[model samples]
Target: MTTTFYEEIGGSDTIRTIVDRFYEGVATDELLRPRDPEEDLGPAADRFALFLIQYWGGPTTYSDNRGHPRLRMRHAPFAVTPAAKERWLVHFRAGLDAADLTPEQDAQFWDYVTHAAQFMVNSLE
Candidate 1:
């Protein structure tokens, strides 16, 4: 049987690491920081970690707690413009890099993230 991406990438621990790193970048990012009004990013990081775990074929904790992702609806209030997407990608890419995924794994993951980022763009700017 083929190993799931979650397993191949080292499961929850690695996902947590990625989320932590990603939020580290987000905390200081001007474009992305304001989108999260929380003074502490811990909640956001936890939610994202769960979401990635479910997305990559791991446990279903995210949906178990939050129901369907409704990603667009959740992000609708934010001005997700092209520039914002790029800024988000920049930090996410850093998180991806910190994962040290294999070349093939990185490509696959990058493809998904880039596509998702573009899809999240609700504005032309």
Candidate 2:
């Protein structure tokens, strides 16, 4: 049987690391920081880690806990302009780098993130 990306990438621990690193970037970013009203990014990090795990074919914990992802709807309240998307990608790229994935895995993961970032753009600015 072929291994899923989640399995190949070392499961929840790796996912947690990626999310944690991504949020560390977010925490310091002026553009990305204001979107999240919470002072602590812990909750956001957990939710993202779970979501990524589920999306990558790991456990279903994210949906089990949060129902549907409804990503666009959830992000609709935010002003996801081109600049915001770029900033988000910059941080996410850092997380991806920290993962130290193989070339194929890196390409696959980067493709999805870039697409998702584009999809989440809700404003023209």
Q: What is the C-alpha RMSD of each candidate to the true structure, in Å?
A: 1.0, 0.8
User: Candidate 2 — which pairs collide?
Assistant: none
Single out the weakest 10-residue window by summed lDDT for candidate 1: 116-125
Report the number of the highest-lDDT candidate: 2
Leading candidate by TM-score: 2
lDDT of candidate 1 vs native? 0.93
What TM-score do all the candidates reach, one by one? 0.96, 0.97
lDDT of 2 by residue, 1-125 (tens): 99989999888988887888899999999899999999999999999999999999999999999999999999999889999999999999999888868889889999999999999999997
Query: What is candidate 1's TM-score against the reference?
Result: 0.96
Q: After superposition, how far is residue 84 of candidate 1 from its true place, in Å?
A: 0.5
Q: What is the lDDT of residue 79 in candidate 2?
A: 88
lDDT tens digits, residues 63-87, model 1? 9999999999999998899999998
